[model samples]
Target: DPMVMAMLVDKMQEACQHLDRLQVRISDTRSSVLVTGDLNAGKSTFVNAILNREVVPDDQQPCTALFCEVKSVDQNDGVEEVHAIRDPEAYRRDDPTTFERLSLAHLRTVVEDNEPGYEMLKIYCRDAHGKSDSLLHNGALDISLIDSPGLNIDSMKTMALFAQQEEIDVIVFVVNAENHFTLSGREFLRTAGKEKAYLFIVVNRFDQIRRKDRCKRDVLDQIRDISPRTYAEAEHLVHFVSARKTLLNGLARSPSPMARGAMLEPASEADLADFKHLERCLRQFILEKRARSKLAPAHVYLSHLLSDLRVLLAYNAQRSARALQRLDGQRSQNEARALQLAKLRETVLDRLDDTIADTAQRVADDAERHLNRFLDHLHHIPYDVTYHGMMYLWRYADDLYRAITMRMNGLAAHIQTEAIRLSSAASSVSTVVAPPSSVSSSATTLAHRDTLGAGNVPALPELLDRAALARMARGLLPGLGALAVGLVGYARSLVAPMGAGAAASHALVTAAKRPNPLARGAFGTLAFAGTLMLFYVVADFRRPLEQQLCRAVGTHLRRTGWVRRHADATGRRAARALRQGLWRFQSDFARIQAEEAVLATQWSRERDACQQRGQRITAMTTRVAEITEQLEAINLDT
Candidate 1:
């Protein structure tokens, strides 16, 4: 009675879970399930059979071309809650034309009418039946039956994300009666083993085996070969059903009552009898076991949640590392650019100073001598003539000085532009690592919600929303763009002063006239001497200017209170968000762990607890197998 009670309890618990899920679906909006298998495995047909309706569009290729979910709603019911699970795309759902661009000849294709449907590879969710509205309304079960493209050649990594989130409960395995044990089916079985539950192998096409001898012998042999392995798993179960037949029965289109059982609606006594068996298995084994299993506590759930969180954190870390690497590389490149800009600034400044020095020396050496000679003849001429000679020399010197200054300023302006470009590059690199501002905001929101206990504890089916994640990324774009542009503008402003002098010099040159050859030759000699003075004075001053600029920027960054406030706010927000997420996952895991621990402790307390069904079953079976092997060995020795 104790053994029976345990089994009964397990079954009852499973039933409750299914009922709870159903209730949630009825109350919640977005819920989904993912169904995957090898080619010709009857996965799609099985889904259609379950709903007692044909909702999934069928295909004949080795793989399913698209991913689809079936949703239902109550027309009369009001809008309830919606639970949507975020997952990675099976194929390229992000791309509108992934189907047209990629050759899926090697992959699964969901073909309708022998023609390929647009490769719509989005995740599928089945809504509870009853309503027509924009959002999932009606107190209907939200069960998304995710129909994945055939898993034949696709990498398991491609499909691993779905299961990692704990989204699947029941896996209906459809095996063709004709080829019950294909190699593909074997591999599929191996993958199923990694799952938390045992698989139900549905034997399709029972009607096709018309001959009694063939049906009896062939089916039995196949079952015998696979049964031992199937039975070994604690939570696994098997079933014999035909989806094609089930569909016909549901449609009321079957030719005979015997065939009607295949669809699910039994029309005959035998068909009804089989339905009872299937229902029994579902209720006794699958549904009940799930309910009876101990609920995990926050800590246990946390461990598992942490595993996923670790994965997410790892992905983000990798992205950040790459971004930082790119930024560093860009910084290196910009350093070179900045260096080039600095050199240009120097060249322009030096050129302006050289021109001024050269012009001044020329005037001092040649113009001064000429003026002195003219002065020697000053007494011979009238006072007005002497004054005119002095005026001419002075006028020429001023004109030359202005000309040199103008040229220098123009060169300086060009250098300023380059500096702006370099500065822009630096700014872009600095802000590159910042997650979109919306990401920060969303993270903060999650934290705030945690404080309010939004996603904490045993956790709701709505753990993480993919749409929210995308929105957060979208929100951060504008700020980053502005930062990039501002850096470039700032670089140019730094060099604007140098250009000013050059422009003034050029303007003066435009106003001046020609000089005598002897005077020009003397001026050139004097100009060379003045060049040394300009470099010593103006060129040496740049180091101090650069230091002052750097200090100002650093001080401004420190003094601005807004940056600190935002950072503190964001940190508090992230801590809260992380805790909430951790709490939700751990609560479930902890509950389960606590239950398991209690069971373990109870087993220690009672000697009979060690005598579990699984152990007993395994030992008994092992002895039987060993006896058989010993018999064969004795016969061989004889």
Candidate 2:
């Protein structure tokens, strides 16, 4: 949208270029005077008076619709010609009277008929006898008198034709003295008054007023009251002149008396003097005030153009600034969101790792406590060296294995609980990190499991097998060692008592009255040696058997290591699943960040373009201001 506006501004710049060229041509032409007023205001009659000839028709009905240009030419033959030059170049030529001549009577017929085909009529004349030398004397600039159509009736059509003409140097507003400043006349004055042109308000037919001085004073006062700005002062702006008297006086001054009497009207010396003064004022304005007249129109056009351009440029700059500001705000919001997501990603990952580690540690500690309790129960059982004792030990080992298996399953459930928590966390945070469409059902569905009972908890694969339980049972060896020590102590207590009884019976049976001391001493020494040997054998077998029991216990309990391995495997699996979900979230977040980066870059480029456009507008505004200042500084009065 702004691009289209930029194109419009460019077109305006081009239009200004054309205006500059038109202004140059305007400055080169003779100062033009456009005569305007309401119907029967004596506008055409006033033009005829100024030219000192009855060229423009003046009648009761409307006559002139097209503009008429009258210029003085150097013609010794005293011939006058009128041409309807539609071509614009004709106005530039000194002698544009080369076209077909239309009689004054035929021109009157065309005006009365109201023919719209003709654009303008050019009349070329010269003073062969130099009768009106004071008016168009030497050193006086050539003047073009343009008579416009009547106002208030068919005003639009009339004004449309007037707009087609070039710069108007002066406006001669002719008002009938009898009516003075009609509604239509005031409206026309207000419209034309704004132009930078010399305005002259003439109260035509002053001779008709019964009290000339009073009527003229009242008319001047009324004009000032209506529009004071139309002229510098009442005296300078108002003129009282009878067009009939002025025309008749000029005719009387003709070289041939017969020609003068034929056209002259009856007029008093006072009417003649008033006409003379009006003529002198007009002549001075056309000559002495020439510079002001030419520059005024140009000054007005440039000033207005510059002012409009300044307003348009200011509006464009403000619009551009507002657009850039909105873009910047959006970019900031996007950046903040991206940062928030990044931080969330880090926090979620950290929490997930901590949860997994804590779950694993709890499972390991639980398995160890269960194994220790099973070993304590096994240690207190009676030792039978027979097959029955061995069967009992195997049964105890099997029961312990079942308990470890159940504990490992509980650990698996705990791990699943933690995994579900992680999945729900990922699901909830996924909505924040990415769109809902990106989340997989598997990851999100886990959160719904919270509403279900324990029976609804999905079954997990076995964590501990027989081999794993056996590994866990290895830690029960110290209890088995204590069992071996008890067996050794029982055997020592029974054997020590029996050995003493048999040795005492053997001594009684083998004893002689007074007994051979050496023989008896040898028997007693041998019996004592046998008893010490038995004790030594039992003591020596105790440590070896205890070591054997420890080995057996270690072999059975080693199966429990399978449970630890299963827990580790389950933890790895869960961690992997959680990691996969986290990775998906991370991937989505990364893409979001990338998209934000592109958007930020796009906004930055647009902002830069707006800034450049603003700079250009500022530069153009400065140039326009400088041109306005130069136009204002020109001394048109001098």
Query: Which candidate gets the maximum lDDT versus the true structure?
Result: 2
Error of 2 at 524 (Å): 57
Candidate 2, 153: how far from true, in Å? 5.0
Residues 61-106, candidate 2: write the lDDT tens digits.
7677766776565321345666765654554444545345576557
- Give Cα-based local distance difference scores for all models: 0.42, 0.60
Instruction: Give the true-structure RMSD of model 2.
Output: 13.3
Candidate 1: C-alpha lDDT: 0.42
Q: Write candidate 1's Cα lDDT for 1-638 as tens digits.
A: 69986986786576466446445533443444456656666777666655555545543444344455444434213222121213334334334433333222322223332254443433233332223311222333233456655555456634553333243444545666666666655655555444322455566555565563575456456544544444543233455555655555656753544344444434455543454465356434333443311121111222343454345445545655555565556556555655644454354333533433333333223323432333234223221112123236334333332332333233323322332332223222212222211212244331222221212111211211355334433433444444444444444333322336766667545433332455444444444434444344333332222222223322333355322433344334444433343334335444544665565455344434223433554454465456545533432111
Where does candidate 1 stray beyond 4 Å? 1-33, 59-63, 74-142, 153-167, 210-236, 253-276, 283-287, 292-638
Minimum summed lDDT over a 10-residue window in model 1 is located at: 452-461
